[model samples]
Target: MGNCIICGQDVDGRICQSHEEDVVFDFRGDSPDQLVRNRFYRGVVDGYADFGVFIDLSPNVTGLLHRSEIDGRLESLDWEAGDTVYVQVKSVRENGNVDLTSSIRQSEGEFRGTLIQERTEEKLPEEVEEGNGSERSDEGNGRERGTAESDGGGGAVETGVTTEAETETEEEPEPEPVETVSEPETAAPTAEPESEAESEPEPEAEAGAEPAAETETAAEPEPREATHSEIADLPDRVDELVRIEGEVVSARQTGGPTVFELRDETGVADCAAFVEAGVRAYPEIEIGDIVRLDGEVELRHDEIQVETEALVELEGDEAAEVERRLADAMTDRARPDELTLVAHDERLEAISGNLLDAAESIRRAVLESRPIVVRHGATADGYVAGVALERAILPLVREEHATSDAEYHYVNRRPLEDAVYGMNDATNDVTKMLQDRERHDEKLPLVVLAGTASTVESEDGLEMLGIYGADRIIVDAAPADPEIAAVTDVLVNPESDDALSTGALASSLATTLNSGVGDEIAHLPAVSYWEDTPQSYLDAARDAGFDEEHVTELREAVALEAYYQSYSEKRELIGDLLFGESEEAVAAAGAPEDVAAEESLAGHIATQFREKLDTEVETAQANTEESEAAGVSVAVLDTDSYTHKYDFPPTSLLLDELHRRSDAEVTIGIAMDKLWIRAETDLDLRAVALDAAENAPNAGISAAGLRECRIEFLSGAREEVEIAVIGAVTEQFD
Candidate 1:
């Protein structure tokens, strides 16, 4: 006997037959024909389209509640994105399009009924003769068969989804029984059973007819409760029937099957369940529902995924047990084995918890097969850190998936100019993710911000992602800001510490995400520094066999390549320069020339790096001007006249070099609209910008992104703004 998930009644099936009619099952089956027409179902709003609201009935089944069927305008329905709604399946077309009618009533509190009948599509109304004892059983097949001709016709293929029933199944399988606590979706249309009950009489049967007799058949095999399988074990169990249980993270309907992302204690897997042609099946399952699944493991298109056969919702004690099990396992390996610190400092120690959370979020992204997009500043440190993460995650992706090209599809490193995640970048991400969902039925990606997320300039972009439920993680050396920290899902920033560079923070976080690549990432911190290498970071590199000269070559090489496109991560080029990767011998034969060529690339780039930075510095110093305010002296450069505006060496990198050579207390590089500064002191440039704006009212000055060695002012008011900025900045020192 099994216990019903809703009422705890012991029964012969997953749910009791008595309460079957009272509940709506989460359909794990494949077809739209399986859904009962005129049946109200509980659903979550997946998103809005101009024509209707797309409501997710089950993880794999979504139905449209059209504006024509709704009581109010679609915009005034009081529904936000992802809100739960109740709607009725008015009809199911042969091509699997489900036309839904809206319900004013929502929630189970409004419904009244005892469900004695579970899902049995073959069973229909039987007419009974009023004066005779005989009855005949004959009912409509329930499917409104024919081609769907309208806007809803093409929606079946929205996500490249082919009907699983028509293509994969050889024959229509017997319909299964379903039961769950029925939650009414609207106020009265679906909730009022008394009116319908009083208006229509019981179904009648013709005289001289008999009910269909039950056929004698072979006894069915008894089903035993299945034990769960870990997703990590799936690669070894290909073609084998296995049982696994987990919470559904996401669900998307494909042309063939409804894919549910099932995540358990160990890992995550995509389990595809099928029902019928174009028709939604099992209208009750939802994302975040704890369920047990039985399926065969398969490799589809070189990627590991599961083909589901049977599924059961686990609630009450079962759900709590599964959750506790997962939590316990998470506590064990959610963080790194230990910290790979650049230096043993109190600031790093204090933020260790945040670091662990950030690392765990990246690791979880890989486990769930979601793409990881790493955005970082395009500088020596930024490239090194981004490369280190790529190195760590690529190997794991290859290990977890059967596809050789999974790295390209599952992981990406995007370089952001000036380490600022901007609105343009966020819009691009949203468009790509939405297209991927509509074209391939994949989940939204996880975004990891390394060296770029701490700046408030990224908040608008982050909020855009949050609208679609994309996860954002931040790992940076920049001091924490409360506003940015609050926006991030997991924030890893060394509070009040500016000593660590983006490279150091990235390498450390990368190691925490995947420790097997620690050796490859250990030398990264040293390669990020153009000069003044911290002793501990330098020692870590020396121990890895990189001396000062070689480290300098690496820093220069990466900087030159990083500056060229500034937007192109050039992952392979950067990875080759930093780690010297050579292709392994092919199945037949290969040459040593390939390996030799790989090692020479970095040195060649380094030579070019020196030539470029040297020329830019010479030009900058020749056009330099000096000024004094209070006791502080400043060296200012007209970047338009000196530095290359659209070439190698970004304004920030150029200013850093000029500052190193200057005897002045501060160095400012001025361009058309903004100014970049480098200072020997750690005063807040944001404060100075505010003061300058007040002193020179027409300048319109503000801190450009982070409250750092940077500020922006109106280009039209440059002369007056410069004077006020110098005065305001100097007063802070006094």
Candidate 2:
């Protein structure tokens, strides 16, 4: 029996049952699942498939492959498709019939190839020997053939004639099997095609596949990096752009933009997103709507602004749910004691209602312990109108204190006097009202006192009654009423009685009264007397008499009635004593009419007294003058007993004459003793007596001879001397 050429197995007695030819075709276009047939190849190793390992098949696809089917060795094989492998078929079926029972397994070891070739006519040496039955038999035949060929040099050709019979046998068809079993006992093994034949050589395709595989590996995206916690925790920067998602606690659509507040559990932030689409888009974003927004943050003075780019509305329930979740998150992270929910709802309400009151409440809550500013307003009448307080002092003031219907401003709890009036008018009003009420023992509440000035002025009997008392007036540094100085006692300290001056008050009152009276009674005679008057008695006589010429003459000769009338009362009595009582007696006697006559007689009497007095005065003046002119000493003494004791000579008369004559220096002294005069000139005795004592009877007097006179003059006087004079004497008689 001969052996099979492909596997070195004996196949001499066996018909060529496994002989078959397969038409090689590229099946690469078909999907991997469709490529296999039969139960053995269903999920088993079929041919070496070139589909990319982990690359082509997703995790889901690769997971379906059986590990045992992939490679024969279970314990050693990795079983992942990524590992390279060789698959082999143990059986094949005819006419599209697949015997699933036919086994398919991977090769356990390395593979080797076998060859099949057509038969040749020349016998091999081994075959020749076996046919001859001896090694020497083939050797003798070969030697005889070689010796004969060498001697004859002739090549031998032999032809066997079985061609017709062989050709007939090859052309005949084989008979069908008598009994055909539907299923075979053992399936014939089928050879697996080489990996290079099974998979088309596609270098460019693999090259292309490699980049795609690489690109996919590269295309796998990574998770984004998280922002720093601290940076994220801060409020948005002044002008940064950002996005925030929250529920709309409140929404307001003005003519310009839709302003709304977004409240996350963390805090409320103001957002103003402009929507030209009207309320259809904006108003729909209600107070409870969940919204996601993109906006820019801006800081203006003391406030923060968020300008919105986009605002997406969400369902109310969803928004509430989100709000609750956010609240929970914030609450979980916040300190328990200090937990505060600064939600949009609360802030919206705060801004809408009494902002000032809200600010006050917030100030009380947040800045309760801090110092506050108190500011108050002053009215035109110097009264307090209003008050405002703040906790912190600002360097610059924004509002001015109003006066006369103006508003008041405050800074840091201090009154801003520069901005407003300095006076507290309200306090003044209150004081006045309280005083008024108190005087009547009235128990009026302060609330009633808080009314306006006009209201208080209209109150019954309260106009005249000021606070304190009528005299108790406010004396401010700045007085509103000009007449206040005239009415009230403006003392430096109004509260103290010692500061009050009654005389000054009376003077003020008199001045006021006089001013009032003077305006009406300015033309009366008594009043005119205090002003300028007529020149003299002659001028008065001219006014009262009949003829100016006669009156002038009469005034020269005697007194006129106008003259008498012109004299004040005290002067008139002296005139009457000098004149007589009747006119007849004077006319009959050829004297002036008694009125004129008495005036004439009185004139004569006065003339007699004056002439006698004048003679003595002239003589004394002459003597004093002569003495002074001659540079001599002169002295005079009064000899009248009563005069000696009681009267002192008038020195002013003598000094007057002496002053006219003497240029020399002089000195005078007075005591109780006799008169002593000394001068640089010699005086005549007559002139000395006449000038020294004009109306006195002169006793002969000399300085050296006056010791007895001095004693007599000194008798009734105090023991002290009475008069003395001293001067430079040109000559002295010793």
Candidate 3:
């Protein structure tokens, strides 16, 4: 017996079974039968052929290194005849032909240890043995002199061994079983040769136990069945067979095997089953089914996974027990301990309860493996709100799912053209979700509205989702209609009349969703405000390492990009602009020069934002007309003629810049069918629109959105609607 040089575990060779693949060997045998399959060897290049290279494993034993196994073109090899190379012995055919494949580790220095492969066994290099446990006993050598016959796969099942193998590894010097390479299931142990079995001495046994020789001749023992276990406990039971009862969260097939994400009361884990390469395993097992999985725990690439042997769906009381356990654990983990706001404000405090509910719903969706869809307006504040939640939710998604692309599959953000969740958007969402549910067995998504869908205009969309029993959460700064409160699962609209940007409200809710990202989203609320920034938010942003100037740049850069591709959610680009940190960006920008170009991308975009807004402001000021109405100074601009219809600065942004430059008591920018109003004094814009509609009954003037105090009117009644709006504005000042 020997201690494994790599892990210091007891073994028959210098390297343990767990790390046998990490070392390369020098083949000392002169026949193909002596060469072990799936073992890497050092060989001398004999010559090159048009189809492959012939490498000599020994003076008389040679193998063909096929071109198909080479990662690149066969002609790319720089090897010369007689040059030494490393290759894996893929197979030794019955016809005495050895098949070889290329090895990634070509140098002896890359391996932990090197051993000489003899006809019967492997031995460590003389120099390695000199320094590492040189003492060896005749009894140990006799005990270790046995063949580890292949189980028709890449694993070795020891034969001609009995007493030591029966004892546990921790107390005895038994050879640890070599794990099979991608085998479907563990095979039954094979008996030794009859000749060898008859030659072995009989063992003294207990009263009723059979003799060792007789036991060898008997049929192989039946495969052991596993007992139920928790998913979280699998890490401690590596290489041991166990059973787990859980609900399947997702089933994904990769190039190699089918991986099912199973969730139990404690946690979630990945269980892989293979029928063939890329073939779906256990097709009857689906997402949301309560099933019992029998598998051996193993670690692949440092992640724990179960190598499935059997999967059967449970029912009746068994299913109910698993479902109840999962629900209780999920509910406990989903609820946050307390809600913490980024900045102190009484308005946010008033809606703290709703914020908690929204956060809990989102967290629960993640634990239950439900996708979340966020809908927000295509504006700066809206994007800020949406991105804040995205940053908070993506980490949770990655932690909960075992797949690499879980973030992409679990969370989605859609930008709204207007600040209303109309029937068109609802229909699109419903159609896609229904298709996903039917085709992929996905659960209904939790729809989240940020800075949109809080008013009566979105009632139809809300009702559509409600009819399908989908979960809904509304987080907006605009006052929600009394009717919307009854429809949504959670409503987080403040009742205060003070200015509350959606970004500020959503940022607070984000912390409640995942407090780990609290520092990352602290500066978002400050970026949402166009002017009159809150002192508390400014302080928080500074504390989070973003100064006022940098925060302003982020806001402007986001606004410019939001307008360009108003419909598309540029998730990664927006995240980079807002946070200036992305592992994907760093990996793509490998070189220093490429990294330098990506640095401060938001600052460059903000510079363009300033130049374009300055040009639009200059143009709008030149075309403005000033007048007085009912002792109130009013300035109005014909936005349709003065501003570029499809340009960097939209009409709403032009109005804001123009209002900043004007000294008028009220600034109004009128387009062909819609108008935006900005006021220095308190004015109920919805009431003003109502008054105008009453004054000009045939004009069809109606309030559209509260964000910009926007009113929609029929293009044909342009003159009448404009006159009535001006009269109504003057009356508000009276």
Candidate 4:
């Protein structure tokens, strides 16, 4: 007996009542397998011709159908590796592999009936055919045979018939008899039909198709995913090669790669053209060179399309002329508008001729407009003009008896006297000649004269001596030796009239000692005293008490004496302290003993004291004389008290009296031993007053005995005082 799976009915050699069009079969062979209706699936064709159709099932693998298996309609389907299709399991082979199909064919009679029914709207073609023909006959025959076989020897049993016609014939012969034989087997109970229905569909197709798809798809790999841009543009993922052209704005070789900045009319990009050989192949390509390259478009940090294969340089100009012009403009713009030329000896020799010519040209240009002021010096016939020139020769000139070397003497003159002499003798001489030439003859054409002041003087003397009376002299203006006021007056115009004055000029020149030559040249010198003293010191002295001539002589002598004395005192002091007899005696006396030793010590000490006293005397005399010359009064107060011994309070009182009595608002008090004096008023008055007081009766203080002094004055009605003690005097007294 056999059971019909579709209807759960007991029968033998007869069909079950339920006959579904598409049914699944579970085939229990050596391996468990399943079979599904062929109509449920559609196959897809891919690149592999052997597998024209693809069946995708659980385990998610692809099943390939042979090209011959695909319906003829799909033979021309040009598919690729990444194609997809639908398929169903037709049957499971004994090998546990799938038999896939897109669709099943109906009998010829069923097909004709289906077409006629669609036209006439009659009952469904499948239903009409089921009634007319031997429906379920195939299934009946399959059940009958299965029953007979199970009953006979329990061998393999087949459920579905091979063909409907064969099943009909077999069923007719033994219908009743087979039914009776299968009734006992079919009568056994089984699980609910719905439960079986829900579970069977999935595994039925998968178990059969999965393995075949796995084998086929595994052999041929899937294509890679396309990039976003590529996906948006193309329907497939494939390697693409392209060519783009742009002008090379900049090119450089780095890390064996030629990086170029390429620019088209629309935009610019950084393109790297790597050449394995070397950059030498493109020798003509440089910065701003244009080039073209070919390579693959690869995605890097930001879709960097590199052309590492080949590159070629295009023809273009270097733009050298444009670059040169830009560089020149920048250089010219960076230069200062004004420059100061410092006149030095070496500089004079270098540009003397050019300076002279410039000065002459300037003089000629300005002569028609203004009268030139003449000063006494070499090249006195010419006048210097304030004008721009290529060069100004500065000739140094010196005085005949000047202790400095002749080479350091006469030179070109500064715009001012103070500036001329303020410079070193060599520089001063050069300045003096320029100033002299500028000041001398109003009609004399300007010419820069370069040399030391001594040279100018020597030349002038020689000229004067040589030609009885030479009226004209030619020389160059030493622009290198710039006078501050001259430079300022000619270049930067200051509002103060004092700027043009001799006093101002001296101050300006003094200010230039530390500043550069150009700054010093801004102001011209006022009094060009090339006689040796700094014009500033002379001017200060004249402003103090001396006349111009006396101040000049005094300043010159002081300056010269200071120079000599500085060296002399250093030598003398060194000798006396270190290598002289006094040092030896002091050392010897330290070890001496007895009366003879004491006498030696006493002699040394006394000699030292006397020497100190003499020095103090000289200093005190100078101070006293200076005070007296400035005017002050001397007074003496004698008392038993030690407080009054060296006090000059009385002198202060006297100064107060003098201030009250005279128009002077300030006074100076001097005190020495038991005498004191007060010089009240201005510098002149104080000097006179101090002289008179020192000579007064019973004062006892002389110019040589003065010990200390204090200056007392009223600054805007406020009382102020400063004291100065004579160190030499204090030492002598001690």
Candidate 5:
């Protein structure tokens, strides 16, 4: 026998049985039937189609990598028609068609095994020598063990590595074997898998077992009804019987237990259900299904886990009752623990229900395995809000999924300039979702508009999703148009309360969405505001241990990072700056290095923020054309001429700082195609546009914002249009 190239185990062929799928092969087989299913193969890029990429595996064999199989934005792929890529052979159609899937590992270095040389009839030199020896041996017994015959599901192949296969991997008992619970008196479910009880000795009956007094199990009367228990409170109730009804967010059959991730409104916990060795318990159970379960709390590996006894799917009215209770509990429990000094404030309370609704949609997306795409403005407030949701949702994702890359797969934050979700962004989402649907069979993601898309300018972009029938949620701290709120599936706007920053609203929402990450993001709301923060919010920040200095550093640091990558959300940097003080994260020697790293990074970025803002504001203020129009102070700047329009510290951020620095009640920035607005008081641009159209028939202007003062006007009417628009906007203050 020869040793397997991987793991150095004795094998009949080049690779071990388990690692057969790890190596990508250069397929020479002409017929589809000759190819092995579930094997990785090296293929050449043949061409691309709108639906998928065509790959040439061999002279007569080809496969398709559907666009849906890609992991990122398909448009960004730098692949050409002739490059090589690795793919997994999924299946071959009866009519000679081949289907392929994206390999999790793309490079040869990523694989842990070696390549096998496929040859026709003739065996390797070593095989020929062994055959000759067998024929010549006079005293040898002619006993033969044959290789595995296909059962058609990538069934076992003989690698001649019998040591581990016979002793461990193939015969090893599942981590925890299923057993029939011999509880004194309990009714059994209709179906149960085979049990290990008959073959194995019970843990309690094993030699060197603890004495009777050491056993935690006591013959006590069971409660008439199962006591409802919170997952977090399971530790205190160890050795006690309890029941929890929640959605089965995840389930996996292991050697020892069928672990189910049960999530209720309160929190998530794992419930281990076992029936027999290597047997799947509750064969009909699946993820995303609701179940009512009874289990005794147990401490395994210093973590709270449930020792499941009875598990049944809650159906009909029973299911409806459980879901209704869960929603009520979530609405109450998901709310931020304290609204800061602002929690009891009259204004925020007015729109609290809307916040809860938006939070519910986001949380539901997590439970349903739907992707969440957060589109936020590339400002400190937008980044803070976007990161707030990211912080809250990521932990839930890690808990719910077995895949290591689930966070990246299920949640994405895209930054938009102008704080608007434009058609360009909509097109990107549409292409991505369609591809995901085709490739991975993922459902269309729930697009959440936060910190942006609360105005008329974003309406067209948001409505674009209707072509695919995708739903959206909007949570804005800006003065939003009421119409935008009405159109969204879920909307939480500060206008219903009072003018608040999106960061503040998102922080509160984050607490309700996942309080587990709330403390890490508590300082975000205060960081969102440049100045004039509410007393209640400041008090909340203070309570969360954020001083004014730290808040300022975070605010400036986020602004700096946001400016650097205006289009891409700085997820990692923002998370570190905002949540560096996490107690859960520890480094070597336990120095709380994450906290230290965050402070250093924030301080450095804040320095850059102050210096950059100072320079940009100076340029904008110097170039500003301050004039009086119809008894209103109007500051008009030729933004295209005066500002670095295409670099970091985007035009919106520069204009915002300029408007704040200059004493301009109404500021109008004229560019080639669009007009930018910033004002001390809310101006009715819709009225101004109508007035301009009435006075100058050729002006051709349209209004498009709530708090933002942008409008669409003819580029040819630049000088004349600005004069008319400024005059019309100035008259509004009257």
Candidate 6:
């Protein structure tokens, strides 16, 4: 007996029965029968086959880690031959064959302790032969080696056979009870007629599936027409046999069965079919194929699933009718009835038609099981917009997909460093989506650029997505170039003459996507606005139980956090702040402690936000270079020289806060290579950049990001570019 290393409990082996899964063992035994079932063992990757990977527990005993046992595509595995890996022994067959399943603990370091599992009593065939005869039997070894090479089967192909010759001097029939039981079972037939020897390995080869195949054939039910039922109705008819006709949304292989996600006009459900353990059931049926499935309804872990008996791909008129029905149903269900604006505004009212179109595109993507990737600016307003959309779409994703974690699978929100979808961002997104398509048979995602990539600067990135037939949607509060409208599938830009925030627009779009959560998101639009919030939105926020003080705390907290990790979604933390509810409270059915925690967290972050912003603003105000151009107050601060670089509150965000505090008519923050402009009067940044470039040709001036009215110039000509920009600003005021 031994004590368990993890739990300190006494057990028969090094690890206790309850903690057996916690530790990975190194099998020191030579035979497959020595391996304890359901225990994790360290194995070496031998080779790869179409069906699975061959993992050798030792030199003689090998197991099949089938493709279905893999969590992802087989091609995605980085394991090479001879590489050390961990696998669980699911079962062992009578023919010395082993079956393996994927181990949750892949690394040896994850285990609390490691131990050697040795069986000292059982001996190898060669060791037994040595005791009986002084010399080994060459003919017996040759016949076994030849049989091993000739047999093309799934079970244990190599059992380390040795000679079974009874007499020491010459060739003879081997004695029984040679200790190595497998060798005689195989080598005994070799001593019979040549025909019998040839046929002997067939049964050994088919040993893995013999029992299952025989049971399946014998228990085959008589043909009968099953009652047709919709996938939505399967939840009510548990354990009942029924037939369903739908389109295959996705097909995934598990260690035991192939789970196919079938979607009909009503809903989606998982249909599991098993041909054998760790084998693909129906290889011909693929995503988007119309098929008829006969199965028994069963509820597993509160999720309705069908245990498939037979699945057949439909054709001709039957296929056409199902396809047409699905298309019509999706169209009716995906599109929203009307545009529901959180707050009434003339700018938003004018773009109601465009907002509805964009909302419909997002809704359709969810219903079709296509992933929705939202790329938004990494700012308070941008994060609010992204979170608003996430809040609305996640519930729908949960309802539409049969999987519990469908929200993470179907909806993704990626933050952009800048409000522009450049080649780098497009390339990363394209690579991931393409890999997901090839590996998992997922459809191309519908890419939504919120408060970013609506301008002409992102045309290249948009065109790249267009080339792959990925649908694009843009929602921006800024004035967008007219040329970009033609390229995108839907454009929701008001092009309003008044100042507006992207959060205001996107929050309304979120409501249009799912109106059931309208009350929860009513305050989001107000949180996006830093100053000069519309009266209607302010009133709406007040009605949603968020006063001005609480809203300010949320806004400041979101902005402060948004700057630290500008490229990550930070889903849970942001969700807690925006909804003012903790995960614990929600899990406990809306406890009041979460509300107090949310307020406390927001207040703490907001305090830090003020402390950080105040220091930067004080430093920036001290080093300001003030002047007057055509009676308009102008201030230029060398941001690189005055403020902290590569720290919290990035240069762009710092400039925005400073500009808001200043009483000047115009604020210009000039970095070494780029400059940001904010003006009280209507100023066209693109025209100003073009004129400045003409005035100082050597400066290499160009408006790189029109979303922020940001212009780029060569650092060598920083002085020249500054003078030319000031001159352009003077002309605009004059």
Candidate with best TM-score: 6
Cα misplacement distance, residue 681 of candidate 6 (Å): 1.7
Which residue segments of model 2 deviate by more than 4 Å?
Answer: 1-257, 263-268, 274-281, 287-734
Please say which candidate is ahead in lDDT: 3 or 5: 3
Better of 1 and 4 by lDDT: 1
**How many residue-pair clashes does candidate 2 contain?**
38
Which segments of candidate 3 are over 4 A away from where they belong?
1-222, 235-238, 251-259, 272-286, 298-305, 582-599
Best by lDDT: 3
| Candidate lDDT values, in order | 0.67, 0.28, 0.77, 0.29, 0.67, 0.77
Give the TM-score (vs. native) of candidate 3: 0.69
Candidate scoring better on lDDT of 2 and 4: 4
TM-score, every prediction? 0.63, 0.17, 0.69, 0.15, 0.61, 0.74
lDDT of 6 by residue, 1-734 (tens): 76777788876656678887877776645568888899888887754543467786754466889777999977678875546789999999876669999987778888776765654332222334433322211110111221232232553322223224312332222222222111222212212223333334433446455455544443523334457898778888886778899899877554345668899988888887755433567888889989888766765445677867568888899999999999999999888999888988888888889988988899888888888999999889999888888888998888887656467668889999898889899998898788667645678999999999877888888899989989999988887787788779999988565888899999899998899879999999999998998989899999998899999999999998898878778887887778856655243333355346567777778889999999999999999889987788899999889988877677778878888889887899999999988887677888899899999998889888876778999999998999899888778886
Question: Tens digit of lDDT per residue, candidate 1, span 140-258?
Answer: 11111111112234542111122334335422222222211122231011011233333455455578767434312322223333345788888888756678877776665533345
Can you write out model 2's per-residue Cα lDDT over 564-595, one digit (the tens) per residue? 22211111222232223445435534663324
Q: Could you give candidate 4's per-residue lDDT for residues 164-252 as a string of tens digits? A: 45444432221111111112332211111233333344334454455555444334223222122211121121133333344444443
Would you give me the overall lDDT of model 5? 0.67
Clashing pairs in 3: none
Rank all candidate structures by their TM-score, best first, as comma-separated numbers.
6, 3, 1, 5, 2, 4
Order of models, best lDDT first: 3, 6, 5, 1, 4, 2
Superposition error at 566 for model 1 (Å):
2.8
In candidate 6, stretches whose alpha carbon ends up further than 4 angstroms from where it belongs are 1-13, 16-22, 25-225, 276-278, 583-595
- Weakest 10 consecutive residues, lDDT, candidate 4? 379-388
lDDT of 1 at 454: 79
Candidate 2, TM-score vs. the true structure? 0.17
